[model samples]
Target: MLEKRFKLSANNTTVKTEILAGLTTFMTMAYIIALNPNILTNYGAGGAELWNGVFLATCLSSAVAMFVMAFLANKPFCLAPGMGLNSFMAIVIGQLVATTGMGYVQSFQSMLCIILIEGVVFLILSLLNVREKIVDAIPLGIRLGISPAIGLMLLNIGFGSNVYIADSNFNQFFVMKDFFGALTASHARDVMTDAYPVMVLSAITMFVGLFVIVVLASKGVKGAVIIGMLAASVLYWVCDAVFLGSNPFASLATASFVPAFGDMASTTLFKFNFAGLAQMGWFTAVTLVITFCIIDMFDTIGTLVGTASRAGMVDREGNMPNMKEALLSDSVGTIVGSCTGTSTVTTFIESASGVEAGGRTGLTALTCGIAFLLCIFLAPIAAIIPAAATSAALIYVGVLMMTGLKKVNFDDLSVCVPVTIMLIGMPISGSIGHGIGLAMISYTIIKVFTGKAKEVSGLTYVISVLFLIKFFLAV
Candidate 1:
């Protein structure tokens, strides 16, 4: 049935096998149920209520994409709010808000509008088959560097969430001696468990999960990610009972079926007030939008390519099978995410976790999508996974993403300089789009000034010009 839908050749694997693989893939990525809401709520959309809405939207969008990819396109991939988009939402959009004096809500709405426009543009480009032109226009090295750069940026954000970097107004830096000192000291024992226990248990969950995957992989066990996640959940439960003196598992075991859409109903959607956008001016908006779209497109492409490559899902052409369809679905996913109340829809590098676990087809994406769909009923259970838990996973994912740096063409100044700019600028500027724009501008400058002018294209020059105007305003 799936083979027919995705136009797969006969001799495809049995449906039963595909189902198991897909569900395993889904379980590995289940962490997103908790992670997305946590990140979005930083903008003041909070409570179980707001998170419930986010959970529903993520599940629905991802499911639609996965089903299309699986039964319709035969590609194994997942889609959600991508790492780069999240950074833009948290940092770049925040900057926009701060500079414009618009409240966070208004800024979120604006960013969403921009993302929606970007999706429409992407859809047009894809349908026109001009995507390959845009992609091929960029140097292969730059295109290749995008995935790893995104990985690094994600790692940077994960670190920022887990570990604080304090600029103490002095050259020296130090830890607080303990991360939980403030919590424990302020509450004077109001914490459910002592800070030490919480940290130790969370660490235990993390390390044990890592160990399970590593050991299982060594033994050729399929579904290592699922095993690892289950192991971590069990450990978390045990530690909760032993140290926290309460079994959180029981409370979390209840089914979750509530959709959080009502909470967001009062919020604006699809209503793009051109007034503020007009104030920014068409040139500026176009420039910013172009920069955002290019970076996001490349960043998402790299993620899809890299994870697919790792999964052996790439064809002889180095393209993921059904690549066009995946991109189409992802483009639409971004638009829906924006309309539903979030940042740009992007491919998560963490999906690599699922790939690493032996998910080889769209079934993986389908499984994840279904799990997300079911998450609407399991919201409370999803919430119990804890920030520290997914924080560890994201940091681990970030570390994995940085491994791509080894594959970079370090000897080529053209590649090395731009890639390094992305590596540093993403963390420093706190925005992947900013880092990419700077790198493109720098790349153009190098190529142009070095008399290698023929290597640069008119579009490259156009983007560079636009980037300069945007970056100056942004700075």
Candidate 2:
């Protein structure tokens, strides 16, 4: 039945391979299960109950979306409430509270209303195939650049922001900025204080696990990525226990075993606050919705195109098959998120890790979705997987995606300039959409200035202009 449903043999995969790939994808992205609630609830400022609500919502909504991806599109991509989008929603909620003196919970509910409307709008556009057409409007050069740009974004996440540590003084540190950037061990120790040892452990684990994955993959190991992550997790646990004298599983001590359905029901379940939105004014509501929509649309498109390219899933023109179905899955997930209480759900770039691990069919996504559902009861166990281990997978996959850059025609300045800008913009801005936007604007400006205006499509010009407004117009 699994073979028939997923056509596993047709995709040159076995059930074992797909299952391994699925678990690989889930482990790499599982951080969002905890991190999303923390960010959206402002580190528990919105209340611990609200945090628990978002936690269950994250798992439930992500599982729903991934299941849709499996059955509707037969794609192996995982979906979750996006990282940057959640931060943006928190910012929007803060602005709402400041503007109208509304309570934080009221402001958050109003934001959920906006997300619901955005999902409905996307669903309508997707049904009309308008979103697919928008994706088609992007120039082929820009499309090709998207994969490499996303690769850079992954690298940024792996080395820069993947492991965050707050010291006794509440001083923050990252792998690249503090550990690698520090001039010396003493300097890092001086600056980071007590957090330096943990930082060192993380760096060692990341590089060593990355090496394990690389070596295993070179030898044609079937489950190299997952194996490497497990190896890394064990190593981190040992190091924490032996060196740091801390229990790696200590978090499990106070962890709640059951899903907090009651908290979810009282806090975010069906909690749309349209009246609060109206108080914020129609224009503000519309603009906020548009902002979320635009960011989410390109982010999804970029991840799909980029990861698909790495997986050899795209046509020569750089478009994926069944894009409409894949997009519909995302829109539906966003709707589920708003209803259950969270931010916009989109395709995670971490899906590339699964692709590299040999996932090729819906079964892989099915496995991932099932894992997310289990996280509701087993979140503590999932949390034990070290952040460094996932960073290893991300860094490895990022390196794999950069191999797509070989397809780019660097001799053409139109391709080189835009691609160049995108390569930098993605890592710097931490947004695949923003990188694509900068590349589009640069590509348009270069063509027009070079007396090749006729080559730029009308839709391309419109998209470029919209990005301009987004960057400069400031709402």
Candidate 3:
């Protein structure tokens, strides 16, 4: 039955391979199960009940979305509440709370309404094939640049550090003058010596794990990254036990493996408040919706194209098979996620892990969906996997994604210039949309000024103008 449904054999993959690949993918991205709830809790302002609600919502929504992807798209992609989008939601919620003097629950309810509206908008776009048209309208140069740009962005995130000063409430990042000043500061040695050893150890562990994954991958080992992450996690556990004298499993003792049904029912399940939409004003609501739609659209597009390219799913023209179905799956995931009280659930680039692990059909996604369901009972175990371990997987995946850069045509200035800007802008701007927007605007300008405007499609021109407006309004 599985064979006929997923065409596993036709895809040159077996049930075993698909299951292993799914497990590998789940291990790589499972940190989100805990991390999402941690972020949404907002330093306990939401209270334990809300925290538990978001946690349950995260798991259920992710599982449902992954299952939808499996059956509807027959693709090996897993959907989850996205990292950047979640962070953006937190910030927006905070702003709303501060500006409107509303309680956390009300602010959260309002944000859910916004996400619900955004999901509906996306569903309409997907149904009308507008989303697919936008994808097709993107120039080949910009499309090729998206993967490498995201690669650099991931690399930047993996290596960046922040220092917390005693008096300051916020973390002080080492950027601009602070980064260069560290080179000659008289307090540099003191700062290094006084720095927490755990931070240093974490960084070292991440690099070592990343190195191990790279070596194993080079040797053609299946699930090499997952193995490396597990090994690195063991090392971290040992270090914590020896140096901190802490019981590594102490958290498990306090964690509730059983679902908190009362908490989930009380807080956020179908508790969305559309009344908050009127409070946000028409302009704010519209801008927020547009922002979410644009960001989520491109993020999904980039992940689908980048991972599909690596999986050999993209054709000579850079189009993936069943893209509309894949996109529909994404939109449906977002809608379900919002209704369940989480952020936008979209296709994860970490799906590339399963692709690299040899997943080729919907079976891999089904496996992942089942794994997510199991995780509802294993939250404690999932929580124990340190960020340092998953950082290694991200770094390794970023390295693999950089291979897309070689496909860009650098000989032509018009193509090269926009692509170069996108490649550099993504990491620096910390936004895929920003990178693609800059590239499109530049590409249109260069083509027009160089008397090659006819080469640019009408859709490209329309998109370029929209991007220009987005940037202008952003400023």
Q: Give the alpha-carbon lDDT of every model.
A: 0.63, 0.92, 0.80
lDDT tens readout by residue for model 3, 325-351? 889877887888787788988888778
TM-score of each: 0.75, 0.99, 0.91
For residues 279-315, what per-residue lDDT tens digits would candidate 1 score against the true structure? 5557756766776676677656656766665555655
Model 3 reaches what TM-score against the true structure? 0.91
Name the regions of candidate 3 deviating beyond 4 angstroms. Answer: 161-189, 192-195
Clash number for each model: 6, 0, 0
CA error at residue 450 for candidate 2, angstroms: 1.2
Q: Output the number of the lDDT-best candidate.
A: 2
Q: Please report the TM-score between candidate 2 and the true structure.
A: 0.99
The prediction achieving the highest TM-score against the true structure is 2
Which stretch of 10 consecutive residues in model 1 shows the poorest summed lDDT? 168-177
Winner on TM-score (2 vs 3): 2
Q: Between 2 and 3, whose lDDT is larger?
A: 2
